[model samples]
Target chain A: MLVRVKSRYRPVAMTAAEAMDGRVRRRERNAALLYDAAAELLATRSLDEISVEEICRRAGVGRATFFRIFETKEGLLREFNRRLTADAAARIDAAGDIDLRAALGHVRDAIIEAWGHAGPGHASMALTYAYHAPERIHDPHPELYALVRQRIERAMASGEIPGVVPASLAASLAVINLTAPVAWTLSHRADELDELSGVLLDQWYAGMISTPKPDRRRNGPRP
Target chain B: MLVRVKSRYRPVAMTAAEAMDGRVRRRERNAALLYDAAAELLATRSLDEISVEEICRRAGVGRATFFRIFETKEGLLREFNRRLTADAAARIDAAGDIDLRAALGHVRDAIIEAWGHAGPGHASMALTYAYHAPERIHDPHPELYALVRQRIERAMASGEIPGVVPASLAASLAVINLTAPVAWTLSHRADELDELSGVLLDQWYAGMISTPKPDRRRNGPRP
Candidate 1:
């Protein structure tokens, strides 16, 4: 009788733990959905105007479910920003092996793809977040920046480039080259991206690696 | 008596016309003030939540004057956008010089200076418009892009650069190089505009003019 009681208690405890784990997993999934819905809603409407109930309705989750997942709307936004930065970092990591030019192209394409996949509302929200919460993205990720600096340093050392452009400057230029197209495209100038990319690459290569032209026509008398 | 009456009426009519012109000019000035105030206020508050009365009060103008100048808030926004674009274009033109690279450097400096002068609120609005209004800046001014293209073509024809790279590509690259730093700066990254300009110039010279180094080692049926 004692053995049977102990076995029953063990099964009950295991079932309760499993049920709790399932609930936590379910909560996390719902929270992600709500965050995504909030981002979409924010694109078209002001953040203050978007209510928790509206998010719950759009996410197909209950109000209790949302409250259980996040403390507030601002909390959800914070999480969204965190996720976006993480996704960008992951994309950069995936593009590790490619040359600077090709890696930049990949970054641009990935951002564009994400924008396309998002609804208009979500895209607008993303833009607002990018503009307003720049600190979130701007905060230096040492690991990412280090990787960028190392790549530039390697390129310079390999004789693919000449002169001593600072690694920090090179990394900044690389990022600028990668990001400008997306900014331009968002402004309804999608046609310019290809042309702009080509121009950027050409100028970057010319400035970094090309030799100076001879000064045949000197201002003063030539010896 | 009839002649005296006619002369008097002429002076009165002229005075009325002058008064009308004065009112128009004052109205225009007030509108500009209101727009500036609205942009400033938007930095702290949501655009939808800010009232016309508050904008007028902040501008030191009256409600009637505000309505007289702008039929609606959206009308004021459109005018503000137009004025800002024109201002940026003028600044870009003012930065022009005989040397293409120097002129480009001036253009970049002008934009950075303007952003500094405009403060965060107005600068943010200008950036948002640039990102949203492609048609406004697209048809590149003949005096700008065309001039750049000609200069690059001249350099190419003279063999200032060793190999043939497309002239159009060269011109576009120059513009993109000038712009990338500004875009990166917008993200509030730690990149100095002057350093970016120098790095761009260095890369352009190296990539376009220098000869490629020959591969040092080759093994083909050596034994």
Candidate 2:
């Protein structure tokens, strides 16, 4: 089941295949075949090693059809990331009771799990935003960002997170922090990633729970 | 004085010109010409819009020399960021007494000021690492990371920042968090970027300054 995630500036391109609607089930079928074939190939090897021709041959689809659908091989990654984000949104949405603080851990676990299943080739492509999905500079993960922002807003309303930080900024910052560690997992620095995230999250928690201390430069004794 | 920022896995390739070393200063001179031409063109137009041919023309160098010197147009960006990182290090190294707390602000201002001077065209190229310089999976900013790590270590020693968070993690996180904001500046969200960074920085401060509170998950009230 395809979940439709909303975004403010989404480049939801109405490609010719989608425009034709029900007229070309073949196009949709071809797209699915390519997606599955790409996924299977990516499981063992990096995206760099895989080719469009190989993907077409594996899928038993014509080489001409591959171009008709995806303009380039990287299109597979965009589709892959889109599905990943959608699936993440679905799962996170279902777990309605997880607090704002636990959400980062949940997201981190999700990324780790996904990478483990797919291997580094697919993992790197999905994690990257600039090259993979350069169409929209604003929404890195539109569906998930919405859910995260909502949670941050709820936290601020309940005083769980300090209301001082803007909800949008908080949500974006949270997502960026947690997603960063995925690349480190490849380099055997997963432990460092977790430790650093702990420091970052801990400091964030520290700031929210405590009041601002008076300036050290203020010439006075502590109250 | 090129500040050679050290890294563990840096692929410092000795291309033909560098391999020849002093034998062919002409190749070196041609490289400088191409680099300067790319930099000047990048001031007004993006890395995308400008072509190697245009850069060669602007430099008054042959098109073949462009390939001989830089290999690709994006090579200019790799050199550009390398120099930018080096310059930032030199400046920060000169400001020896600025505390760890102030370093984030310094880096942010440097990025912001650099963006202002270069415009969005060059701004985007310099800020992005994956596309421009994808060779290294680690060492996003080797020089800055070293300096930031040292500062964090010093802060930990002084008890200004909590010693719980590891120094390496702290430095990596600091650099990543501050760098994330540059893309937003182009979208007219510069103010929001500063505000969000404050939220992030404030939280980091909060964590370091305060002891871990007893868990809200615990059955008993605060001790």
Candidate 3:
């Protein structure tokens, strides 16, 4: 004989949780659409020329939705910037644990790949604007810095690298040197960014690893 | 015997030339005064916050003279930036023909000294602004880049450096790395700028010279 058991409405609780998850996913999707629209517009227009209305239109979202996600156009742009930095940081993390040379190469490739989404011209301009803002440039991208510091520490501890420089300083130097060429290429040859970036990393890493004495003879007279 | 030929009105001609020279000098003095005043004001305020009237008042010059020297307030700021870069370049040239280490030291010193004129906060802000503007950041500072390139070429040619990197790429790396640290110090700890800059250069240079095998052990763990 089977006893009749009363069944609890567990499906009701599951439905509520699923609804909450669906709401979150919807919000994320809306924000992503807006970000993508802004990036597309920003690729051709300056920040000043971009409007929230146009972004909403391109994103297929209402003005109310846009406002719910972002406070202002500048705020939206800042969000985009933050997202880019975060994505690059994520890439850096993903590329970690490679040998020093491969690690640097992977990191560079990650940055370039992330930047390519915005196109060279837009990426260059965005970086230029961010650099001029009052905020500390490196503070927004702690992951990248941590990656550099970690690489330097590992290289130092294993006696795999020649430099006696502190990890922090070396990391800073690597950040700047590796970045300048990409900026240079963006200004001079956007199409050649990949090639120039490779050249910069190759030459810089070579110099970093090669031991040589300062020559006494090159104090040649200036013209 | 003094031979007095036909009077050629030499005194009158000399007077005209001297008057012209004096007028030019006065104009230059007025412009310099305006620049100094702007620099002082920019130290404490953003460029947008600075007004033409306030600048003229601080400079003790008429607004007309300010306009005469500079088309707009932005123009004045650009000129100021240009002057600072030129001064640094001039110092780099003056410090040329030294040994590899000394040349780098002198160049670094020259750059720091030139930057020292503006309080660190102002200097850092100015650089931040310059980086964002549409104008090319490196164009106005051609001399600085040339100096770096020249040094690298000399070092490479004389076999003073162990690395076989191209001169141009190496130079870009040097410029970016060196400047980034000074900029960092300005915002983070202005008082310790000199000391921090020295450490940065020392470590970076050491890394550039030391030969090390890329360590393969640390690529063991990925976070």
Q: Write the per-residue lDDT of candidate 1 for residues B112-148, one digit (tens) a residue.
A: 3333333334434434543232222212222233444
Clashing pairs in 3: A132-B128, A215-B160
Writing each residue's lDDT as its tens digit, candidate 1 over A1-223 gives 0000111101223445787877666766786677767766765676667788998899999998877666765555445433433343345466564333332232233322333344444433333443333222212222333434555676666666653555665665543443344344434434444334434444554465555333212111211
Please tell me which predicted candidate would have the highest DockQ against the true structure.
Answer: 2
What order do candidates take by lDDT, descending?
2, 3, 1
Candidate 2's displacement at residue A136, Å, is: 20
Name the regions of candidate 2 deviating beyond 4 angstroms: A1-21, A24-30, A37-67, A70-74, A97-109, A119-223, B1-79, B97-106, B119-223
Instruction: Give one digit per residue, the lDDT tens place, for model 2 in A74-142.
Output: 676546545544444444466665432223223323322333355455644444433322213223234
Clashing residue pairs, backbone N/CA/C < 3 A, model 2: A203-B203, A207-B206
Best by lDDT: 2
Instruction: Give fnat for candidate 3.
Output: 0.04
Angstrom error at residue A221, model 3: 48
Candidate 1 Cα lDDT to native: 0.46
DockQ of 1: 0.07
Worst 10 residues of 1 chain A by lDDT: A1-10
In the order shown, the candidates' DockQ scores are 0.07, 0.11, 0.05
Residues B1-223, candidate 3, lDDT per residue (tens digit)? 0011111111223445787877666677887778778777776676777788998999999999999877777565455434533443344456554332222222233223333344433444444453332223333234444555565566666555544444665665554544444344333433443333334344345544544333311111221
